[model samples]
Target chain A: MIKADYNVFDTTHDTQYIYRKLLDCMARPGKIQSIQSVTRKLNDFPDGLSTLLAIALTLVDREVSYHLISDQSNRVHNYLKWKTFSEQASIENTDYLFINQNLGEDKIYQLMSLVKKGTLEDPHQSATIILHVDELSIDQNKRQAFHLSGPGINGVTTCYVKGLPIAWIKQRQIINSEYPIGVDFILTTTAGEIMAIPRTTVIERKEE
Target chain B: MGYVAVTGGRTAIENANKLVHSYRLKDAERAIEVKEIESQMRLLVDRVMGEGGLYAPEYAALALKQTEGDVHEAAFLLRAYRSTLPRNHYSMITDPGEMRGIRRISSSFKDIPGGQVLGPTYDYTHRLLNFDLRNESGAVEQFLEDFALELDTEMDTPSFPKVMDLLREQGLVANRKIDEVEPFDITREKLAFPAPRSARLQLLSRGETGAMTALAYSSMRGYGAVHPTIGELRVGYSEVHIPYPFADEEEDSIYIGELKLTEVETVNSFTQNNQGDVEFMLGYGLTFGQNEVKAIAMAILERSLETQGQSPTQDEEFVLLHIDSVEAQGFVSHLKLPHYITFQSMLDRIRQAQKESKVETGSKG
Candidate 1:
């Protein structure tokens, strides 16, 4: 008898709304979407955990395994396990990896390298890395800007981010060199904003 | 004249829906109750349960009444309802040999264990309709009272051994090692060509009964080479259990409930094994509720798919893709939807071709 708390988020309607937002972002890479309205209704979650929890509650279930990085106290991990009934797996075998932006660049690189890239036969088996970042904006004033051109974009679209490491993008490029066999990235902010960079998208750094 | 798109289509659709409701209530007789349909139309409810792939009898009855007794539409409703649900647990593997059978029979042997108890079947009944059912309120109670006296209440219910087991013991049936691999769930994953046996079985078990019967009939009528004898057909209740989530021991499980099922095992022609020993092949089918025809047809088509042949029934993709009632009915019924633009485009192409042909004929003359 697994008891789950439903007060913070509705299992049906909330998850459905979050899933639709995530799907829209995934389809149009570099497109920013906000779920602040939904997350604002939630309370008592630590800084940045509410947005990540919203995503986890939408995608994570008993069918998949997840790994949470940068949670030294395992609070998020335990809550996720209790709420979603999902098992905690190692980085390599996990289907979803939730990473905090505070994690060092070196650790992020190591984790990204070890994550599953799937196989030629079943590319959908690949892992999805959800990274908590500071901010995502369409304005070019942010610290780093990426010009994305892919199946989802019309031709090229530039998206700016504040706290994501440039090295991680390079590592993603290397891992995704072989088409259709790579991890997808969903960058979420503390303010409940999200933008996706699917493996099909080609990202290039825009010079200031 | 060019096809003109209408503006009041929404009002028309709304009125059409209202008209459907009106038609359902036009009869002066009382509206049929869901419970009555479930209990009185047992076989029809069973057919919907099998085809809809949902075992909720009350919900199946509701779908039947809502669809005005259209089995296809009722099944579509149930399947659509099933999609909104979340899958929480996978049940433990069940064995049909443990079923408490209400009806059991075997065509391969005249006298078998359990002695062919034909419980609540119309097989031996005449096809003629009796007028007595028009006013059957008193007859129902009287018949039940009379029938109860004839039943042997003192005897304990007997369990029977599987007919296939006897053949296996005699080395007459081919040896098949138990496949312990986790069965593929067709609902979770999109089906691809050259599907695994688990996916094939999942699709066939919930397939449309009339379509499956027709395909099986085609095979029997010389379209294919599979003709099988019923090894055993059993309609019974089977228990379902799920692993307890918080249990410390692996053996700990919770008994969820029981389901009424129809299981069929068919014995086919002999085939040589890798070592050149000849043995009879087998086809198996199982579905929710007591749907004997669907179960038998499923067994025939299951075996037909295994054989290498040019027949449509032997084509896995052809048979499996077309057998889904919801998919088949949806595709066919979608033709009734507006296709004005497409038809207009086709008409334009034909008119241009006619003009070009006329110019060519005039120039040649």
Candidate 2:
């Protein structure tokens, strides 16, 4: 029933705005950007899936593939296909991956490794992971800190993220060690905030 | 130079727009209707439609009228207008061979199955202008009278078959293996290097005529390694078909109305295939409306770029990036925008360099 109810609102204007926000998030690795969607009540959707869905509705199309890692429900997959017309791909071949919740360290590592790392000739062919988390905060005591330095960052900037296992970052580092051939991440929260970490970013865990 | 920057910016902008409007309506001899432009200035409308990548004749006419016959600006206006439209169902694959061909020619072989029909082209016309239309009244009436008489007899025309089918039958042309993979839509995603054939064709279809012509000409003038002959050039209407939505129904597809298209197939010299067998490859170009020159040139450039020879025109990035009417026009027009800050920075840097040189000279003395 929810699959049939999924809608794309303010199709052009909202998509353009969301697209710019997504671009800005990727351009500035540690900066948090907000996405405004017609579906304002993010709590109605299962686990922070609204933020991922909002971005996916704007960006995904039939040309690319979409994979849902944390979502076991066919409803979400069918809803994504119906709304965006994007192909439902397996984890290995997906252009965009929607992770509805934080996974265990082992599973995270396995998923990261399994995801497509683009070839050097076509670096943008790599997968983009949209990860939904419980909270995203900069408080060092409450969240794990990340030292980010990349093409987008003016210099090194430290940012903290919550609701994800600390070991996941280490696995991400291992997966993204090869330059120009790695997956990117769009860390999202139920509050409609997102921070992008492209493969170019040099990530270091401040406290293990 | 010392004058203070003027205020009332919004008022100034409004007045500047009024000035342009006044110039546009300077004489007010006659009001030009969109229908008049669509009918009378047809070639210009076709060019706009091709470059704009939209096949709406009325809108193309309106865009041409709005831009005062500036081809690039008219196309830009049409493209901007197209953004406001909603995405409907994508039309099914179009077969140009099934077109009701008004004009069909094959330069590869002169005495083929069907003789060439040079329909409504100025290819053999004299370059001198006919001055009789300068003060001619009832021009439209005379034209309609002349053409309407022939329409009755011309209605029973036959469909022309593709010349490439002969080559395919003889195994002379390279065999095309149909790939079931869905083609990438360039408008949806950013174009990557070593682009797919679909994206390449789409870009070339919407490319500006003059730019594509220049690149193709360069390739022909010994800059590249493709000597192309127009194997088949067609100007006709291709029917658009879309699949019917109901799953249980027996009737599978619906016929959307026909779209006028110009299709060109160019035959290049023999080349070794991947398996080291020699075969003559083909280049193809198709665009909206009767735009044969652009399609022909586009076919050559498509082949040239595919070969990836040691020339600027053969470079996919060079040809694809530069040929877009919108992008090229936008970039060239951006120079007219106020660049005081950037200019001031450049001037400061130059003056500083000059002062440093002067100081060095004084110290040396």
Candidate 3:
């Protein structure tokens, strides 16, 4: 029987591996690798995003509320609700919002506008976005010359991203200018490679 | 206006699982049976069962077999398995007075009422390996013939009194009551201090033998001071305690009767006077399986840990806290998981540090 196990006391070997990977992912802002045991099914997610599921499964606990812009079918929403026991929320009242290929500027802007601004009492209460981008590479979009000069970036780097929106980059830059108040991102390709593009990193897209 | 489509975390995870599976099983050519560990490597099985906090020796043997003799893995297996089974009934509290012992001896007196029945023991047996046992065609007889008797039949020896009990009756040793006071169960609840000797013994009994031994050794060397004597060492099946449904769990939780396990209980003697004439009973340690040395050492360490005025071993919290195999194993194996995120932050810090250092060097140079 496929049971939705939520408790830490009932941890499995693979679950522990997933848990550790999640910790590693969080500890470093924008670097991505595969977490253990999650599998992708076609059309289940709009962006075909499975890593979102992995992250949601790992961290979207009962205490948190999640909203989806791309998954209107509520397959992702219901699945997360059942599997991780996370509460469904509107864009207006959400701790986190998961967006993918289907979401446009209006939806993202609306969601971001509703996010609670960081307060002195709880800065972590602000909304975080787990944006799935298409194609992450160190040498992608040479004109943009995306230099990854953050904590995990070994040195200055340029990467090409095919599916990521230009406005989103501008939005990200605007948000990140506030430091400690910007939303973080995880960009994944169709091939399943990940490069964490956190709020802290600077990206200059080419061919404007 | 831009719409970026990105997300496929599931595929990465599936491959990681495959790698883990290959790392564990596919590489090994031959798989070993659990029975071999239970039968041949009995001592390891015993230690695993003792430390695992599970009384079932057979299951412990099976885990040891599966883990290829890794004690921590075996312990983790036991822990994982332990939480799965629902606690059916709380066993009655068995008294040491009602223990049916096969091997009982006292260091103070060579000849007691039971007359020292050293059942199956390695004590006095030469440590050298015997080559003749390699080609045994038939069933071999017991090394000591007289001790072996029919199962379920009582030995003709008189009912013997506990060495500590005798000492207490004489008014020559410190008196502590094992009466109505309930000893805390570590498994059911979180441990609180200052723990009673009974609570300490409960912890010591379930503790890993090696870790306990190291703590005891440390205490004996410099950590704690308690010149211990083996007042009595008994190995036999004792009655287990199961709480009756009708009885009070607070005041009288355990109802007594003969039980399921085979354990060795050791009683330690602590000297109270300089002349060493007047003495005190330190504590009792009982663990599942036949680990007499471990049992004896555990009792000694239990006493030394309680009173840490002058000895390093006296620090009970420090020693008892680190002696858990499960905790140590979990903390150590956790490192095998990824730390890319933390490393990224470290990279940033290193660049910052190097820049500052370079600036200082430039100023100096």
Candidate 4:
């Protein structure tokens, strides 16, 4: 049995539970939910950032080559190390990537550099990313936005999230140049919420 | 300014060894002796080896003591240790028919060949605990001699066909054959779904005993409807045959694996088909010790699983997926690690979500 404290849980176990819950969420598609006791002790990293650790530990191990990118690679690396048991590698050679940056053209371009796109035979083996975004939303016109359409969404509805750089959308439009090969993203909140936007999702920037 | 130093590989290796030593030595006074564990707790030791997928009885016994009786952890320890040992040779698959006789039974036809040798069986014993076993000695040999004296000579009988084969011969059922791709060993590779049937059975065979029993019980209770009959259940020692590259197959010593006395049984063809006779041998369940029920359930579930209907037992994918004790325990218990980097990612996402919607962000939880 896992020990729990005063509404506080070990980030490790919490991440594992969250991993299963996230799997359920992803498979079900478009279900918005939050997990408890996950981010309570994740002090240095963002709240709910433990979700990334959950993903890493569940997915990455001795077998997978991974790269953890952040300016403060030292602190984050230690926690990542303890969480994932993953051996580190340079950004270029990574099979899985964890990026902590804003969602702008520069950041988007920065991430795109690491995309392997994979081979034609094994599409699932391609490089995947967990991009950390700060804010996302629509412009004043409400037309230039991330109006979504997919399995979970009932219809084409425009929903806005803030703190993301407008350039991120621009970069996706460029990546849209090719299909069947691109990156997948799981936009997770410091509060442990996540929205998965694979390379297949279309994104366009609003023109002033 | 907040970034910590990257520790060198040398120091990390030393620290890791220290951790392993500490874990191994946690129980100082009650350190479990390997020999006693092997002798007294034979079944548990056998189970550890059986599920661990290792054939070393002593090592499995040693691991059981180290784990303080956590069967899954003991299996894990044995497996982790086994992984380091290089594969020197491949074992020639032993034919179960060649097994030296100790005990054998057939439910389909009770009065068949060998007259149901009930050798070394605990079936007829009452539930009362016997304290006299501690003092008993040479009782087995005496019993064996007395049973032989009654028989003038073993009666010669032809090897009978399997119970399922009878159903298949009449064509009263459709032959349900599943053609799936090769599977990666779960221990050697990461788990992904929808996994192939081979992978699922590998996971389920070594699954936690209680959890698996519950699921099996549920299937019988109509959560999943599977009517299974005992085809054959046998307990005895079969030679472990390992084949060397240069040696002939008859040289059994070339194989380096243990053939512990085991009890393996499988469910027979219980398919109720008025239209046709469907015949299938569900599982060839193999285990280390006298684990009759587990092996039988495993076989029944395997047969039931291949059929793609809505029986609780019929949902092979679901039962196979969730019933793995080792993987489930490992991943669930693994939540004790740290994840500050992921938290940072979460912080970034929520701030963006809040800003886009113009909602005041709550303090990072």
Candidate 5:
């Protein structure tokens, strides 16, 4: 069904815009950027699917494989495969993993633990996880704040994200503890905002 | 003096572009059609296509005309255009053995099976320029009409068996095991050193004609030990097919179209295998269109890179990195861009050195 609706999305200019945004966010970790203009064109699709799909369409292709962890039906998985022509692979073998917000904390931990961190010689061969969260903001009022400090951050910066369990961050820390061999994360929200936490970025949660 | 960036050159740049357009059409002659370039300048189009790594003849012709016959620029345009396109389907592995050969030849054996078909080549012809071609519009039609009468249209086109198969049957040529692993795509991934054979072949196939030829020549001229015999050189059309998306069977595929390609397989000197059996090594080259020289050069360079030698051709990094038309041309052309700051810094260093030398001379006085 999404394949039939693909004509609404401009593969050229739209993907180019999304790619630039993705690149910007990836370079500056935890910096929230929005692709609301492009995703607005796909309003007919379900919430959060459009934003995730936009990112997937920009990055995934036949050369790469992706794994989707969603409590929702297999529709999103089938749509991604058909649209991008990227194969669906197991967690360890997949180059990308798309985790939906509906997944439980234990499921997220298991998925994160299994994702490939890649070997020292080929750190870039690691998986990139695209997770859908409820919301992301720089204003740290009420929401849990994450202290982001690394290659992209100047000294230290704070990113407040809602609905991302502490378990996921803990698991990510364990997996990425070994330098240069860790998975990158691209967090997207239903409102079409996106942020990146590359392997080089160190994320620390500020307890209340 | 501090370097300052030059500004307000927008109008000048625009005028310069207009001047270039005017220069292309100052003669006021009838515009040469894209189709004419595609058909008449067939070899040129083929060269651009091979280097550009895109097979569209019409696009290649348009690129040639747009760049005013600059081969490197034309190929660069095509490669840039290629980047914007999305990869939809991966074609099934094409076999050159099934090619409908228009021209096939072998220099390895004196009289091998599927004897050499010398189809449309000037290898034996004199190099003298044809004065008659200057105003031969009438002669072209007349020649075509006369040439058509000699052909037997009823005969089904002949397909030839590979020359390497004969050597392979006798175990004179080393038998390579079928590698089922998916080939590395250079476009998708950054090429790392000690590259896989797939990446090497991809880079070589799309390499610039003159650059590859020079390196291959260097190898043949005793810089390296890869003076290989042309085991088989075939120029022909090869069909491309993609697996049917809805098909349940593996064999079901849709025939997309055919591409004109020149394939070369070279036979090098023999060496002992792991089993201690002596066998000749094979070098392969294939390109988009009928570019015989590039393909042959590719074959030579392919073999040369595999061999351990001190020659430039034998060094994989040197040959592979230099052969890319876009990369080489872009880097060389970039020197023309504004480098005021860098140049100024260098000037400051030189002036400082000169001042120090003068002080030393005064002290001596």
Candidate 6:
């Protein structure tokens, strides 16, 4: 049950606009879009959480299920269920998995592996993973720089994403190698910039 | 001048809307009430409700009036309105067998336990328009009086047993194992390919009537292999049930009024189940109101698409994606929206191609 104060503010217009941004990000992988936080008054969450919460409100509903991997308390889970009306699913069975920056390399690896790789017949049955981070940059000097080349990217797009485990880029490659059966990702930063990396995108780790 | 600006068309847009309203109300006749439209143009109302994916007659009628009888526009308005509403609770699985039958018939059997009740239908009626109704003032009152008199004697007895139960008893129909799987709501999420049966049914139920009929006709006309016999066609009101709030298994569900639904259970050719036993497959369809044609078409199309065959009707994406009136209307009507940049680019490309061709021809000359 959701608290009375937990409100999905202006679900018709704001939520739809946020979804459009999410769709655009998904369609053009590596393209960052801003999702304005409308329900910031509800909870004074951590830095990058407002956007994640907004996304939960926009996309998650009772028909769908989500699993939260956050450093925040179980309040986030209750808030999501209450506001979005989405069912709380296990890590293996979730449609959307929210992964905050707190998870270590080992936990990320284990969770990524456990994430549902939908069957060949129904590739869309796979989970969409939303990772919340501090910032996203395209600076070459960054340690977490990635070279992406795939369906959405023109030729090769190199970018830096903060708040993921250093080994995550390689881990994503391994998980998504089978084509179509892998989980898609939307990485949101504290600055309100969100970038998507679908399963079709090939993510290569760029050494500093 | 055609204004394209950051701040323009405020007054022009306002007048343009006024212009539309003026056009809609141009007739100097008496103002048409929504209730009149709801009762008189019931088929149209039903079509709009089905396509709109909402079952509100008053709303559908108002939408029709607002859109000036444009089916797609009316449906779009209803759909847009529906998007603003919050979902309270999902109705429990409704059994069509429990429908208080107004009109019930089965094409497969000569006679059933519940005899055919061909209640007020146009099936046998001549297509000629009644010119007498044009000047008729007390037509509505007289019709109601006659209907009231008829209903006094002709009210159907309780418990209209379903025709399918007879087949089930004889083991002709496929054994239906009751599963507790929740039906997917197609309105909430984007429909993915190889969609579940529940999602497919939901989409088909809300699909445009004409689109569904055309597709079903194509299948019958040899595009796909499905020749269905309507096991039962029922049009009546069914009670909508929702789980009692915070109630346990012992608690009876809550009844949230009744909705008029058209239901069809089509029996297609027998096919072997996974166990290699011959069992007749049933295609089911139910939609809002007295929409028999669409319901029948939907039942046939539902069966045709269930096999997931390569044929046009069998292909889920081709049938399901195209049948949605709102989606079809939006995609088709969006062309009317300003595409200035795209048009300019296309013009540039055409001119560029022409220039290149001319250059080649000039050099050859």
| CA deviation > 4 Å runs, candidate 5 | A1-7, A20-45, A118-123, A135-161, A177-181, A193-208, B1-11, B139-144, B147-155, B175-178, B272-278, B359-365
**Candidate 2 true-interface contact recovery:** 0.00
**Cα lDDT of model 3 by residue, B1-365, tens digit:** 34333446678989987886566677678666667667777778778877888877779988876675788889779978997653545565566555666677877668666678777778879999999888865433553244356532555433346766666777666536545766676766667677766767777776777877877777666666755667777766665765443443545555454432333333445546656566565556677777776787677677676564856567777667677788877888867656556677799999999999999999999
Candidate 6 overall lDDT versus native: 0.84
User: Which one wins on TM-score?
Assistant: 1
Fraction of the true interface contacts (Cα pairs closer than 8 Å across chains) found in each model: 0.07, 0.00, 0.00, 0.00, 0.50, 0.00
Number of backbone collisions per candidate: 0, 0, 26, 40, 0, 0
In model 5, what lDDT does residue B173 have? 85
Instruction: Sort the predicted structures by lDDT, highest score first.
Output: 5, 1, 6, 2, 3, 4
lDDT, each prediction: 0.88, 0.83, 0.65, 0.63, 0.89, 0.84
What is the lDDT for B190 in model 3? Answer: 68
Q: Compare the candidates by lDDT and give the number of the best one.
A: 5
Chain B, per-candidate TM-score:
0.95, 0.94, 0.78, 0.69, 0.96, 0.93
Model 1: per-residue lDDT, tens digit, B1-365? 77567565898899999999989879848888899999998999999988999888999999999989999999999998998776677789888788878889999998897699887798999999998788887876897788786666624555679989989988888846688888888878989989998899999999999999999999999999888999999998888999886566988999999889999999999999888889999999999999998899999999999889999999999999999999999999989978878989999999999999999999999
Residue B227, candidate 3: alpha-carbon lDDT: 56
- Error of model 3, residue A188, in angstroms: 45
- lDDT of candidate 2 at residue B334, scale 0 to 100: 84
TM-score of 2: 0.70
lDDT of 4 by residue, B1-365 (tens): 36444455778789987887788777586666789899878778877877787778889888987776889899889878988653444456566555655566766556644557676666899999898887768877876888785554544322333344444456533444545555557666666776676777677667666666777777777776555666566665667765444333546455454475444445545565555544444454555666666666676677667767776667756777666666778888866544466668899999988796665343342
Q: What is the C-alpha RMSD of each candidate to the true structure, in Å?
A: 4.1, 6.9, 14.7, 18.7, 4.0, 7.8
Off by over 4 Å in 4: A1-208, B1-32, B131-184, B189-194, B247-258, B261-284, B335-365
Query: What's model 5's lDDT at A39?
Result: 86
From the highest TM-score down, the ranking of the candidates is 1, 5, 2, 6, 3, 4
> By the DockQ metric, which is better: model 1 or model 3?
1
TM-score per candidate, chains pooled? 0.88, 0.70, 0.54, 0.49, 0.87, 0.67
Residue pairs with colliding backbones in model 5 are none
Report the C-alpha displacement of residue A39, candidate 5, in angstroms. Answer: 4.2
TM-score per candidate for chain A alone:
0.93, 0.87, 0.75, 0.74, 0.92, 0.88
